[model samples]
Target: MPIIEMKQIVKIFEDPKRKTNLLAIDHVDLNVEENEFLCILGPSGCGKSTLLNMIAGFEKQTSGDVLMNQKRVDAPGPERGVVFQQPTLMPWLPVWENVSFHLKLEGVAASIRKERAKEYIEMVGLKGFENHYPHELSGGMNQRVGIARALMLNPSVILMDEPFASIDAQTKTDMQEELVKIWEKHKITIIFITHSIDEALILGTKVAVMTRRPGTIRETMSISLPRPRDVTSDAFNRYKRQILDLLKEEGELAKAASRSSS
Candidate 1:
């Protein structure tokens, strides 16, 4: 079975007084297979995050169904882990504590939590920084802590929302490489949201290009390029050009709609 199934999913934000409420996602259908890295790419306000939230059980679809392994998603569960744009860690806690906070919340023993935290902290390349606080680390390192924190749940799927967007270019590239390594080693299914076509090309096994709001999948393309991708290669640039053209069409349509509506 596909790890996650989004069937005819539509998401609308209702307002009692307003005649027209916000309709973010249209009737979109997608199947996320097991152990594949899927990247969702679209313009701002295009419901990429909304669609991800639905799969994470953080938001309910207005209609249709979002299922994980044949089960409908209604609420957040341990089975679906989430890493947001910001690390959002506890300022007072050290890296290890932040990583194991949920275990602490669940009344897990301190010694066990410490050992578990060590395992993931090391996995994310933060072995010696376990004792360091959030403020003590660089932006990229803090995000690594966030990734380790999510991995602590041992979730079946990890949903990320532009997680490396705020980092420096070099760090972002390095993080991308590390993430690919983690995906390969763990064999975990990941659904990542991003605005960068290059990042999508680098990280995804499958890329879903979405249209402007009332966002739906414009196309889902399988990316078969070899790992440690060379962006200068013909195949990489071809995919980039294709996505750029599709996004350009959506941008033009959006502008025309604005002019007509006025």
Candidate 2:
């Protein structure tokens, strides 16, 4: 059985002005396999993030269901860890403390937390800056801390919401490489959300192209790209162009909807 399943999920948001309910997601069904790296790619408001939120158990669907390992998901648990766009770290806490925050919540001792955080800190290549605050680190470094914090939970599934979107090109590439390395080493299942075609192509085993507002699954293209994906390679460009065309189709539909409403 698929490790994660969403069966005909639907989510609607009521708009007071339109006096209408907007369907953010529509009859979306997906099955994610074990240790698979999946990317949900679409334009803004396509409900990619909303789908991730549902899997994280932070949001509920208007209808249908979400299941993991044959059990219904009703609430957030340590088995699933999410890294939002922003770091969301505790400003007052040091790097190690932030990474070990979950353990603290579980009433683990300071020494134990410190030791556990140390291992993840090193995993994300943030060893020497254990004493630093969030403000002290660069954008990419802070994001690494966010990832490390999530890893410290030892969650089997890691959900990322455009986690590298805020960093510079160079730093983003570095982080992406490191993330793939981590995924390979730990064999963790990752469900990533992004608007960037290149990011999706480079990272995912399956690239799930989503439709525009009232989002639905348009296609789930198997990447088949070899690891250490070269963005400049011909194969990479080939898939990128194909995915771009798919997204363009969604964009045209969105424009038509806007014009009809206007």
Candidate 3:
């Protein structure tokens, strides 16, 4: 069985003014296998983040079901870790403390927590910065701390919602390479949300493209490109061109739908 399954998910948000209910997701179905890097790509307002939220158990679907390991998911659990757009670290705490905070809350001893945090900090390339606070680190370095914190939990899956969105282009590329290294080393399952097709292409084992508002999975295509994918290669461009066409077609359809509704 697939490790994660979303069967016919639908999410509707209420508008306070009774103007109209917003259907953010419409009957979307998806399944992810173990240790797969699945990147979800869509235009803004396409509910890509919403889908990730559901998988993380931060939100529930309006209809259908979300299952992990053949069991229904109703609330957030430690089995699924999440890294949001921001590091969301405790500014006052140092990197080691932030990475092992959950363990601290669970009444783990300080020595054990420190030792455990050490493993993940090194894994994320933050070995010597254990004493550094969030403010002392660069954006990409802080993001790496967030990733280490998530990995500290030894989660079955890690859900990322554009965790590198705010970084510079060069920093973003470096982080991407590090993330791929992490994934390759640990063989961790990841579900990432992004608007950048190139980023998705570079990271995911497969990319799932979504439509605009009231988003649904338009298609899920396997990358099949070799590691350290040559972006300049013919195969790479072909995949890029294919996804571009899908996005363009979806954009046009969304605009037409809005015009008709108005």
Candidate 4:
């Protein structure tokens, strides 16, 4: 069975001024298999994040159902972990405390929390900085702390919304490599939302492209390229070109809609 499933999802937002509903997702169906790294790509305002939020149980769809492990998702639970674009860590807490916050909430012992945090801290390569506060670490390191915190829950699925979008180019590349390594080692299912074509091509086992507003799955392409993908290779370029074309087409359509509305 698919680890995560969405059938005929439709999301509508009230446009108070216009007094009309704005459709954000239109009859979209998606599925994520176990241990698959699925990347969702689309132009801005295309409901990519909205879709992820539905799976995380942060948003309720107007119609249709979201199921994880065959159970309906009505509220957020430990079974699905989410990492937002920002680190969203507590400023006062040190690295270890931040990563183990969930355990603390569960009433786990301090010693056990510390030990558990240590494992993920090392996994994300923050071994020596456990004592440092969020303000003391670089943006990339802080994001790693967020990843560690999510992983500490041992959730069946991890939902990431452009987690590396704010880091420097070099740091983003490094983090991508680290993320792929972590995914391969842990074999966790991930639903990642991004606007970058190259980033999607590099990280995903399958890339699902969505259309502009009222987003629907335009195409879901299997990325059979081997791990540690070579960005400059012919196969990589081929996939990149395909995704680029799709995005370009969506961009044009969005522009046309805007012009008509104006």
Candidate 5:
């Protein structure tokens, strides 16, 4: 059974000024298996991020259902942790406190929260920097804090929206490796959204390529690559070529449609 399922999901946004409706996602169905890392990939404005937001319960769909753990998901909860592109950490709070913010909400004792937060902080390699605020950390380090914060909740599903998009290439590669290591240890389900085909291939057990605007699933490619994936390997190149071809076709179709509409 899948840990997360979306059945024929549809989302439409209204343009009040233009008196028209914008279709963001079009009857998309998706399933996420337990402990699997699934990546949603597509070009910009393709609704991949929108689909992720719906799963996060940060946005509501026009129709269809989102089910997780055999229960309907109507709103956000601690069970579903989200890590946005930006760190979104509190500037006033130090790294330790930011990681323990969820516990603080539940009225947990300071001592207990601190102890729990320390474990995750160390897990992300920020052991000595707990006292530093968000401003004191580098972009990659801040994202590490975000990841640690989500893991601290022991969430059933971790949702990451292009969390490393803004980081340098070298740092992004490092973070990807770190994420896979953490995932192997925790075995938590993750729904990650990204536009980079390489990122999707490196991280996901399955990659769902989406169509351009009014997005729907174009194809879902299964990846059986071994751990510590070799981005330069022949097999990796084969898959990369295939994904690029698909994206190119989708891009052309999107351009034609826009031209005709205009």
Candidate 6:
């Protein structure tokens, strides 16, 4: 059974000054299976983040339903963890403390929280830096702390919104590789939003492309490339070409729409 299901989801934003309702996402249905890494790909302003927000329960859809594990998602819960573009860590706390903040909220003892935190810190490859502050770490290290924090919750799913978009290209690649390794070990469901075709191809087991604003699913593709994917291989290039062509077509359609509206 699908772990996450969205049926005819729609979102609209009201503009009081213009007396208009801006349609963000059109009726869209999607399903994510257990242990699946699903990447949502789209152009800017195409409602990819909006759709992810709905799944995260940060925003409610105008219509339709979002179901996870056969339950309706009406509010945010520990079952779903979100990592935004920014790490958003607490500057005052040390690495281990930051990772165990949620445990602290639940009134867990300090010794127990620290013990639990250390395991995840090591899992994310941040072992020796447990006592360091966020300001002392690199952007990628901070981001790993955020991931560890979310994982400490033991959530059934993880939602990532272009978490590596701000980092340098090399760091981003390293983070991607680490993420894939972590996912292989944990086997948790993840819904990641990104505009980069290469990133999606590199990370996702399946890719779902969205159209321009008033976003709808353009296509859903299963990636069959082997683990430790070879970007230079013929199979990799073939998939890349296919995704690029789809995005190019959508880009032109978006341009035409803008011209017509003007």
Best by lDDT: 1
Give Cα-based local distance difference scores for all models. 0.95, 0.93, 0.94, 0.94, 0.92, 0.93
Residue 251 Cα positional deviation in candidate 2, in Å, after optimal superposition: 1.5
Per-residue CA lDDT of candidate 2, range 1-262, in tens? Answer: 8989999999999889989988899999999998999999987888999999999999999999999998998889899999999999999999999999988988999998998899999999999999999999998999999999998888989999999999999999999999999999999999999889999988999999998888999999888888899889999999999999998988898899899999
Worst 10 residues of 4 by lDDT: 246-255
TM-score of each: 0.98, 0.97, 0.98, 0.97, 0.98, 0.98
* True lDDT of residue 143, candidate 5: 98
Which model, 1 or 2, shows the larger TM-score?
Answer: 1
lDDT of 1 by residue, 1-262 (tens): 8989999999999888877799889999999999999999998999999999999888899999999999999999998889999999999999999999999999999889999899999998899998999998999999999999999999999999999999999999999998999999999999999999999999999999999999999999999999899999999999999999999999999999999999
Give lDDT tens digits, candidate 6, residues 73-131. Answer: 99899999999999999999999999999989899999999999999999988999999
Error of 6 at 113 (Å): 0.5
24-56: candidate 4 lDDT, tens digit per residue: 999999999999999999978889999999999
Per-residue lDDT value at 254 in model 4: 86
* Candidate 5 Cα errors over 4 Å, as ranges: none
Error of 3 at 59 (Å): 0.6
By TM-score, the better pick of 2 and 6 is: 6
Query: Which whole-number lDDT from 0 to 100 does residue 69 have in model 2?
Result: 94
Which consecutive 10 residues in model 1 have the weakest lDDT in total? 14-23
Poorest 10 consecutive residues by lDDT, candidate 6: 46-55
Candidate 1 error regions (>4 Å): 17-19
lDDT of 4 at 184: 94
Tens-digit lDDT track for model 3 on 70-125?
Answer: 99999998999999999999999999999999999999998999999999999888
Error of 2 at 225 (Å): 1.5
Tens digits of per-residue lDDT, candidate 5, 1-262, equal 9989999999999999999999888999999999999998988887888888888888899999988888888888889999999989999999999999988999999999999999999998898998999999999999999999999989999999999999999999999999999999999999999988899999999999998888899999899899899999999889999999999999899889989999
